[model samples]
Target chain A: MPRRDPAAFAEFVAARSPALHRAAYLMVGERQLAQDLLQESLTKTYVAWPRLRDHGKAEAYTRKVITTTAITWYRRRSWNAERPTESLPDTVAGGHDDAVTQREWLWTALQELPPRQRAAIVLRFYEDLTEAQTAEAMDCAVGTVKSQVSAGLAKLRDRLGDRFGEHADDLLPPTLMVVTP
Target chain B: MTELLKDTMDQAADSLLAPDLDVQAMVREGDRRVGRRRTAVVGAGVAAAVVAAIAVPSLLPQDQQRATEPVGFAAVFEAHQPSWATGSEVHVGGRSFDAGHQVFAYVQTTEGVVFSDPSGQVWASNGTQTVGVGRTDAEHPRLEADGSRVAWTTYGDGRPTEFTVYDQATGEVDGLAAQTGDAEVLALDGTDVYARDGREIVRWSLATGTRTSLGRPTGIEIEDVKAGVIAHQLPHADDGATSPYFGRELGETLAPDFYQTLALSPDGTTALGESEADVPALADTATGAVTPITVPGYGFFVGFGWVDDDTYVGLGVNEPYQTTPLDLLECEVGGTCTVTAEAIGSAASGVVLPFGQSMDD
Candidate 1:
């Protein structure tokens, strides 16, 4: 087996940390937890660096590690128990009031989803991956990815509809509305 | 709404400033993990080699062993196929047989191998012939075998309503209706069938057709049972920690912590708990003593089952990060493990081991 190149690993981490951390933050809904998830995933990626063969695919592998590890963490009772309460800002200090509220609502709704559904949504919408790619990342079948993504979108719409009433359709993208229905 | 969802997610992610990348720390942790894994593999290899060199020849003569040893539960432990094997294949005691249908759960008996397919149809294969025994619910069906009997729970309206036991000797199948409608079979010990009915563990006697409540229900989740010994987890604490307990006396804890999966040995004397290092530990059910068994080349052990009283088997994943290339490993309580079959496929492969069927599902 070839030895892992430390310099190459460092370069990969430096280049991809920003994007991976963002995705982690979206999946976990917490800054510190996202940081921890990213760091742990990077450590795992570093360990598998030698077997990775093509360093170009490191980002994909790290994304998968993040998705699976996040799911594992969420499955633990301790992680669910220790989840901090979401405290949305009461007043929109800066203008763009409706957009801020919508963002807050969407974020809270995303966090409310089950771990697998949340991961599927993030991998599909946020990462712009296909259903097959999402399944690969989640270590599940493509059918499972489709169901999870649909279930997640339907949940988001229901929450949005409950809150926004008739304006829910306007808030959701046309493509999501079509598939979810 | 796809565009909006993507845009919203992007905006939310972009708003948070990225935490500083700790390249040095990551590298250090990565090196530590690799070193620990390599050390375990090397140590296990040396121990196995030493045992093979010193113990094999002196134990017993081949002819003498064949004459004296009884064919029983130990035969089940010998059933394993290559990791890449499909569900249609069955291997037991150095012999391979075709089940025709994809086997999801199986056990080896003195007469033949009794197994369940993905459709929940039970079949028995005896080298030359295969016959259908019975059927259970295709979804999440449970099967257990001990001595000459094979037992499984039958479902009605998505809930377990009864359990059926098949006698390999007489080719008789007995259906004993459960006292409770929602009970699921946990383990089989000769004539006694242990099951979890809601939060309480119940024991049913196939001989007398009577149900006995093991203990008061405190909303416990039964993990496994052997003989009359029951392994259970208490409800989650305020801190989200659940303690494992053995037998009816739930006040005394068995181990400080265990990973998601737990199983008791067939004799109920030892319990397999995953340690912090991801290796399986043998915990003495009575004394609460834990001994970590060393397994080579695997980072994690899951779905544990005892082949006999002292020996156990589980699925060993070589790389925790990557789910593929799982190996079926057999390890003795205080001894090293031999990879019974290598590359037994990934978690998604639908390969089932005799023990740890619940965890595999």
Candidate 2:
């Protein structure tokens, strides 16, 4: 029967929306969809604000909401039907180094992964969350997180190898290079 | 790769300019949702009371006569427990008791309720005392009950090794050695138990101690079985799409992307079809026609079992979030739902319903 403080909710949203928006953009790979996802997730957070008890963890809660909602959205047949307009550049332009092209390729490849795998990769690497935290965000077991991240990274590496040949190994971090047996 | 992946992600994300926060708009939408939920709850309560008022007068004579009869699935809804009951608590018809441990999953039988604790120890409580039946190491052990028999699978090092059944009448437990350790018990119907081992659906006879293979079908895994009818999901397609189907003939597809638990009604004529994004629906086993059932004020329903051929009991989750509380609901197919109990706590709290044993497994 408690009421949610709109002013406090507004303050939290204003402060955290930027970072959450960035994460959402990485998740959905579309600017407008990311904005919508963030707004919808924040609305849910606001409704559950009364029971959230600790406002300190609100960001984590909203992040979880965004991750799950994005996955669910991607699961819909209609959402999958609508592809992103952004495409990877075919050739590197003047002043654009190989790193930029590789990054662009990685961006497109990341979008190609399944929603769960993409969310796992983003939560694990982009967010710099630990495996446990990533699992918590994804609402899955730690072993599942490891498998998803490993599988996603392997796909990225395979695609990178196809694009850059031997240079792929050099681009990959040593710690992640050992994920594959 | 972590650093490079992070940088790439950052660059991609940074390309987008963060939009201005619309705090007022979000607050308005959230408040509207909350208001609608509150109104629905109140309306449902008023409707139930009105229905009860009108029906009680005409049903008094029959209700008195039926009071002496044995309690069944219908009796579960008639029984009520305090909202403070913990997840380990068990409530039968007119009786309630604690199972002394957190019940991860449970099923109701004529003799009592059979449940499994977090440690894989299975127990049965007859609304009086509890008895340990067996233990299973399956990651998500499923319990099925019919009449006085309770069936489950016992695992060795995470693989199912035996099909075990307990007779509540005799208080005796029996085990049949699993032909393959990969097999897990899916349903118990009278003298036969159905299990999916590898890609085959095998039926083992308890009376004769013999096994029969039902042949490998379209589905990669069988979800539930009742009266020889199987509810299952086809293998993930090349596009990652899986459809749920029912019946021995595999005639009709229930719903597309029914990735959650698919529970069959007691009569096997209907199956509860659920998905991540849509409301729960009752799918006809014979025709695979889906009738979406909406539990007023709740995000979705997780059906435990059918009280009758038409009515099912389940938990109406407040929202899709993990932290939200659940309301015990009894709903009729294509009809109204009554809140049997409200705010019974969340699944994380281990609030096990009488028929919720197979849920989320």
Candidate 3:
């Protein structure tokens, strides 16, 4: 945001748009719409770059923008869910890997839940945000985040059965590995 | 358990995303917007003065009693996003246009500007948002819009000239079977469709599909019509007048001096015309007065459309008018103008408009 280093903002957007794109795709269930959502949010974030105090908080601001904008769009548009095909992906021959199959089932089931619950689950588990942080991003109470996460998880279990809870450890975000003390 | 679920999330994310992305193009597109906002604010001062000296007396009165009065073109832009804060990727057939061609002959809509491609495909954009309509291959395709509804003609192998209309607000596209014989759809005015069959001028209802014959077949020809405003030439009985008729009720006729009016304000009182002057100007249809309008930074002839009763958007053309540097020019009725494009006539500016239309067209 410093007047001297405008490149700093560009560097941040370039570095984060992929992960942001992924999260947006999860929320919106379409590639093109997700890209537009991300671009719109990023454009807004850039316009306000000068007012931001901590550069590290840029991703958080963008994340909040994504979550809120995605939720706002729900009133006007309902994103189409990507259905898992009965057949396996072309990579495997006439059969699917058990782990990949379960993940695909979870992806399809996640899209069926209401946007709030899905966003809560994505933030709590996929983005590795704690309950309070998820609440902040969702702009709701901590209890609502917990209940939405529980309800979303319950739906996934109901759709995919007990196998859904077996991969609890997989809920932690992979991006967290890059952070250091 | 959390780590296990995180893996699933990461894998799902990967499956949905593409492998390569041009972050630089997006980043630059965003920055270019930011730069335009700053530059426009600076350039508006000078352009406002140039336009005000010419236009204020037209849109507003510059009486000696009000000599100190500050006059400028202003719109009810309460809470409207600055033109720069919006951008969208061009998508054709569900696939985004990477380094895609820009659109032309666009008209202002409730949401944004609607334009057509060579294939008769159409797209709408304000600055940041874009959506495509179905295709039409009618050469010299005319595009018309009233807020969200847009309509244009299409030729199917040169038979049964068709019209495609799109509503941006509802995301609906509809086609009207205009005429099968040798006829041309001139323009769309709200729900009315203007078409010509032989020498007879016809007005068909786009919603009800009912037809009404406006005038008997005579020597006068219909050039174009929008919102009940008709631009046509009177019969050649008196040496055939060259200028076209403009305005609602078809009252005022074009003088021999003007280059023909390209667009008119919503009220149909003001006409955006090309004069003997190289640049485009605003002609007062009520009076015989004319004001040559200019883009503050760029001097080339530009593509223009009325945004509202008091404002108009223009596209800056490079010298020779081949390329449209994607510079967005916002002009107010009594104010100067500002452009959002980075530079004028530069190699890197807006999309390349290979087939150019004259300012009068």
Candidate topping TM-score: 2
Weakest ten-residue segment in model 3 chain B by summed lDDT: B43-52
lDDT by residue for model 3 (A124-151), tens: 7788787777876786778888777777
Chain B TM-score of predicted candidate 2 relative to the true chain B: 0.69
Candidate 1 ranges beyond 4 A from true positions: A1-34, A37-181, B1-85, B109-111, B157-160, B198-200, B236-241, B248-253, B276-279, B320-324, B346-350, B356-360
Name the best candidate (by DockQ). Answer: 2
Please, what are the lDDT tens digits per residue for candidate 1 over residues A51-152?
Answer: 455576678878888998899888875555679845444443463877777877887888888889989999988888888778767867888888888788
Tens digit of per-residue lDDT, candidate 1, span B1-361: 4466776677767677767778999987787555433321200000000001111111111121111123332344333222212476655554455657677666655455677777887776554556687777575556666655667777776654777777655566666677677667776666677777655677777767678887755545555556656666664332222346776455455564343235676667777765433445777777666676666666666535555676766667765434466666777667777877777555445445454132233
What is the C-alpha DockQ of each candidate?
0.21, 0.22, 0.11
Q: What is the C-alpha RMSD of each candidate to the true structure, in Å?
A: 18.6, 16.0, 25.5
Tens digit per residue, CA lDDT, model 2, B1-361: 4466777776776666766667889888787555333211210000000010111111111111111223343334223221223566655443456656666666666555677777888876655556777787534666766556677888886554888877654566767777776777777766567777766778877767678887886444566666667776654332223356776654345554343344576667877655432346677777666666677676655555655567766667655435687777777888898987767666556454544242333
Superposition error at B292 for model 1 (Å): 2.4
lDDT of 2 by residue, A33-134 (tens): 889999999998887676455565678878878998999888884455687746543433342577787887788888888888889889977888888778
Question: What's the lDDT for residue B86 in model 2?
Answer: 55
In CAPRI terms, model 2 is classed as incorrect
Q: How high is the DockQ of candidate 1?
A: 0.21
